[model samples]
Target: MAAAGSVYEPLPRPCAFSPRSRDLLAISGVDGRIQVWDTRVAALRREYVPSAHLSATCTCLAWAPARGIQEAHQKKRRKSEAVDNDDPYDILTIGTATGDILLYSTVKGELQSKLVSHHRKVNCVRWHQDNGCLYSCSQDKHIVEWNTQTYKVKCKWKGDSVGVSSLCLSPDGKMLLSAGRTIKLWDLQTKEVTRQFTGHSTLVTSLMFMPIRAAADSRSPPETTGLYFLSGSIHDRLISVWQVRTEMKQKSAVLTFTLTASPVSIDLAPSDSKEEPMKLAVVCRDGQMHVFEHVLNGSHKKPLAPTCTVQIATSGGDGDSTPKPVSILSAGFCPDKQSMVLYYGSSMQPLFEKLVLKTDEPHMCLIRDVKKTLTLRKEMTVTKVKTPVVKAADTKVLMPGIPGHSATVTAMTVNSETQEGKRKPGDQEDTIEDRLGAMDIALPKPPTKTILPRADHFSVLLLQGLESCDSNILNKVFLINNETEIKRTVAKLPVHCVVPLVNEITKRLQGHPNGAMFMVRWVKAALVHHAPYLSALPDLGAQLGSLYQFLEMRVKAMQKLSRLNGKLYLLITQIGAFQMAQRTSMQSSKQAKLVYEEESSEDEEPNKEHNASDDNWEEEDEEAEEKEEESEKEEESEGSNEDSEEEMDVDKVNSDVDPGNESEEE
Candidate 1:
């Protein structure tokens, strides 16, 4: 077993490709910036700096589909060939920290409009793939549906206590699912929260609506044959397949299957072959990219486990046979059905590559040399260069996920009956000489100027202070490579340090203040609503109540301290007056006693006065005892005041956590 393992080393680190297989239009984060990448050449095309809400980070991005072809044709008739419908046109909408949703045009790269409706951070935004409607969920605990054409909010549905992390619209746009901890499904037409899914034990990270059949299938029935939704959660490490039950009056759903993986991202394959099962590409935090093939077996009446698996090689080393796991940050299906692209990053720059899958076995066939027959306008055109043609049998097996240009053949086959090359009626004799034998041919001359595709323009909002790099300078830098290399520039942004204030306080206090503490109160009221796990815990309500009480007590104590300070000022004033009066009275009494004693000694005799003092001394003893008790009570009050000062010190320390300053430095 050891020898066999040694022979099959782990996979190598995936090769990075600059020219991506698919278009990446928009990227955003909490640090108010939006980056756009050109898919063709892997370059940064353009940057947009929105003036409003520059401090808020962008959380979600969505694209709205273009209108019909007639409108596109009319626009193209005007000298706007660049604006023609050759490229996909869509409305790009982004959600930000300030709960504002900004919409822009992908064709013109212009900001179309903005919506300032949500009260808190907007977490997710989804545009109806088949309609002009938009759906957004925020930390405000509400999901709003909007008419993209009129820019009006059509309806709103309240979510659970916690903010939503992800949202998915059914393929037909009839239903919408907002998931955080509990998955809440809403009827879009009726604008009501219809059903709640409660199987996941943790926060749901991603939700996707996978079509049961290809979206282009005209024969698919709207009610039964369209799409089913799949939900993936971080805590549960499971992917739950859900389908709306038509038999039920309310269109309730049931979970079909749960996979054992924390799917951080998912993408469906774009194949229309009926025999080909739906493919789900899942990225788990365990540094593994799992490709699951959903098979609907007729006999079993349920979906089978993945039919085939492809483990991505992450680490770059000799262990190529035992595929090293990698944390796949994001993944998407390419427009071409042959490949899928995945994006990954660690502490270093983000890397991108394509994974091609083999759909057919190798076969020996003949490929005609079409280049020899066709001629370009220029005689020395690169497209007209004639290359030798080989019988497909001479070629080798092609593995999926390997680049077409450098693929190595694993196997080969040649037909003995077709060993003699025969020309067809249309085939020319001169062109036949170029086949089956190496011949000296003149190389094609290189063109004087290489024509490159026009750069796609996009806007990037720079974080505050990042503008010191001159929005123009930053734009120039990003646009250098058509925005494809923009991933390298992400390091220039200020690194964000995010720590829950309540968690920090809890750690500092080592479990003091119970639920009613000031820190606990802030978390329950302000942060819990934003947290993903708020709805998952059963004791959240009681915990929040205790936290509120702790906050109330702290507030009351602060108010009492203010009142006590005022009373202390009055006591100090009275003490000053008493001290002044006692000093004056002591001086007067001493002088009077001396005078009396001198007169007594002079007028009578010392012996008679001394005998009378015993009666006066007995009365003085009771007055001295009362004075001593009063001094003891005053000392106790002074000690209590000192204890209050120490408590104040603790309060100041607890309240001085500055998140903004700390994040800025980081």
Candidate 2:
């Protein structure tokens, strides 16, 4: 719907793409008009106003999968008992301001049922694909599950939030995510709140679950379940991706990273085949639909960066002329995955190549060949949807919830064939490079044909993000675990880019114990790998020269101080020279005594025979007696020494362990 000179406010939930046909788009309008359009051709297929919807506005719409006759045939073949499946959903479910749900059949082109669903405006309705259940929530602060076939209430429960604004369910129908006071992740089977994510600065406006886009990369661990989802906020203008791992003992959604965008609608673009990288389409307050191709870094598989972006023009208008910029309510990618012929990884990274179709041009062009920028234009058609402007006197104000206001999006949710419970990217923040990859710029992407950002741009963005991060995160760049990666990055970085980062690292590492070690290593790598590049940049070469001079001065000063200290030590040793000279004299006297003893022994050897008979016999007898006494004394002394040693050891241990012992301090 369009109004001239006035902003269009789309419903909290506006448009949905058909999962069955993959070509049909069902859009709910404020004028209670449900329009079906062919997504493939961008042509209006049909328009219908449900008689059951009495109100002026259709709040939300969801398309049920196309029901086939095969189910009935199988039932008959198996001889199973059954009643009529009245809810053959080749149909659409519409919620309106009158708290009523209108189920209209696309096949029959008529309303199937008008169920009075809630006490107030029906906020959202979702068709559970797996369990074949329909779920709806409202301002009544309750979520009700309806049996799709019977249109009967299966269950209803009061919610914790005063008004539940949005709802999303897991693909398996075993989990429910509700957003209002806060975002709550609930286990459907246990009927218990499993986790609550609290960082949304405002009311969570829209949310969708996506399997990790680049999860096919080899580094991602085998997962237990695919429970990753993205949530967007209004006041914060932030999008947060979360990973919830169950099946493991760990049970909470870990916030991976944040993107700053004034998002209106977000969805994934339909891929050509299962093996293709997931393409994400996000529509912000800006009218352009930005389609980013998800690519995993080859060095680190878990790191996800939109290496390429292809923006397409989509607005709210009929065919034949340019579409007008209407408030995008919501969008979804078609279920059909298109197949195409392609070649990659031959000097081209998946992150580096992107295909975009320009509005003026009929052909798709590789973004890499384009210049530095591209501008998006929003063109309106000749005819417009005339929505009446409400004057104060023309419409009654109900003043519901203090006369508040409302919130569009488009999405394609892909199912990852990878196993469940794969380790989430957020869990492996073991390196500074990972966090650097996580850091996002606050600046909106410039309109451009070259979606592939220069590596230098990435470096500048990383520097900016690091500049604003907390001290702990800032210090991560210098950490030992990341030093190797940091050096490798430094080796490849242009000198101009490295300058600011060097300052940042130096500032962060000032006075750090390992600062010198890392700096030495970093300098070594830079000099070795980047010498030629640095030499070419005159400014960079001069800066290196300055640092070299500073280091040389420090080294010279240190060497001089060491020499002076060694000379002072030698002077102090001169005081002990007198003791050294006395030891030398004692050594000479000992040598003379040794020579005399040798001469005496030689003379005694000959004299021993002559004296042997006389004095020698007497002396021998005396000597024998003396030897006996000495031996006896030696035996006694040895025994005493052992006893003394044992006693001393016991005393020493006591002293070592005693409470009052002074030696224990030493």
Candidate 3:
């Protein structure tokens, strides 16, 4: 595994495979570092640090389409100079948490431009192949289009309230698809939403624009046929396919497919020939690859199921040298559509793997069972019988079909077992006699069924506690087990035990308010870990009803307490102000007394010869000291007045604070 400060970190977004070259890949790290990798050699080709600040986290990454760059340069005058430059024409764009879009030159290994417009983190970015324009959506609820040449916002529009989590551009560059809390298709030319898709239960995490085939054998390319797209969500684990056509008379219905895990990325592999079926590649959060075939044609009214599922497990000789499940960060089909590239593993130990798909018929077998079987008749008839010509002793022998003995002869039967046990003439003697003194051939047998204890010890303990209906035991069980252990225990619990556990939690919430928070945590963990089971159960409704009631009561109590706390705070502030005013008054009075004492000491000093001169000075000093004392007394009176007003305010606040009401309710 890589260390903390290593170059490799958990990828903020899956590595972006260059649309131009199959060998090039762009990966953005959580630490704002971007590295372009060459898939052919599995080595880093260039690294670009978009920002030197360590806090800048990368959120999204996209590669400028090769066709876009070519078309962009075709309009420029100095074509030879542009072609001769050392930097590759393809640009790698990376979005950061600071809402800055960085365009980096692949060959030069440096940033080309940093576009800043949005105030929140950028979620998705895409480059228009035909216009060389950049489209970006952010959490700021703004979808801005940028002119690549000027590096400025060309246009902007308001996105969804939940923020656009993903974006897809149509091939014609006239429409844009945005997915967030909902999926909406916008007319880029008109800058307005034309269609809105509903049915997703969670925020959409990914969007892909898939082109519809013009004909089964049409020579036109797949890129030109753009009228469909796919959207997926994290929590729902569903992929919905939608078709867009203004001429269609019927309302477009969404075809939804369920997935084992939430999809993180979706890519389309359009077949070049009719024999090859169109394939959809979906990479899930759990590092699983689900490939669905023949789903894009307009023939089906239902969602197409995945044809195959593949999981990439970590290899040995790494950290612990044990095979473990790797979480896939990103995955996509290669340009050839015959293989896939996968980025998986922990942020600290990120790894890359390539899977070569078997698309040809030779590698795939349709026959599931190849075993051959034979049938035989119950009876057989002999066509001819051969008779042995024996010597004079067999002259009186019966015919070949004659029976020699009765079928019910009472005698011991001897077959292969007896013949095999018989010792041969050349067999050697036994090596030694068997030891019957100490060792016996007959061994003691174990009990058929011993009572073994249950393996889920904590769950068993919790069940016992619930069965006994003891609050203390339940509380002890909860306190001893952490959240992870509790979740594991909940998963191990049988389906029947969940309802009782929930009921117990509800009881605890009602009877023991002090432990309500703990009980709530337990219930939340249980539900999160075993939601599929608990949701299907009908008995859970009653428990959840009581649970919600308790929550509502608690909420009301909290509101009351908050109001009381505010009133008490006001009282405290008022009392503090009063005490401060009194303290200031006391300090002022002490200073005035000290001044008076000093003046009296001067007056009592013995100065007979200079008494006449000192007498005049003493008179002036006494007059000034008397004025200061008068001013200090006035200040004391003002302070006392302020203090009295503050005391009244404090008393008024105290009158409003009613702890008795809260106690009674409790």
What CA RMSD would you report for each candidate? 30.7, 28.9, 34.1
The residue-by-residue lDDT of candidate 3 on 166-238, one tens digit each, is 8998867888999866788898888988888876655576888766556676877665554677788755676
Cα lDDT tens digits for candidate 2, 1-666: 111211122213366656533456666543346677554544444566423233335667787654621222232322221221433445778886656788775544556667765867676787777667788888678888887666678888876556676898876677898887777887777778887776664556677876543234455443342446777765454456666665442333343322334566667543323355555655555433344453311122132433332333323234525543323334445344322111111101111122232323322223221112111111313122222233333443221211112111112233574355577767653488656666664657778775775644423345544445445544454453455665666665655445445444444333564676666665565566766655443123223433554466568889998999999888878757877988999988778554333336677775677565674677778888999999999999899999999999998898778857676576
Judged by lDDT against the true structure, how good is candidate 3?
Answer: 0.64
lDDT scores of the candidates, listed in order: 0.53, 0.53, 0.64
TM of each candidate vs. truth: 0.47, 0.43, 0.50
Candidate 2: count the clashes: 27
lDDT of 1 by residue, 108-158 (tens): 555667887897777778777676678899877888888766677888767
Q: Give the poorly placed runs of model 1, Cα more than 4 Å off.
A: 1-21, 29-31, 68-85, 214-220, 248-261, 270-276, 297-326, 346-349, 358-666
Looking at candidate 2, what is the lDDT of residue 334? 39
Which pairs of residues collide in model 3? Answer: 10-347
**Highest lDDT scorer:** 3
User: What is the lDDT for 305 in model 2?
Assistant: 33
TM-score of predicted model 2?
0.43
Q: Please give the ranking of all candidate structures by lDDT, highest first, separated by commas.
A: 3, 2, 1
Q: Please report, as a residue range, the 10-residue window in candidate 1 with the lowest summed lDDT.
A: 1-10
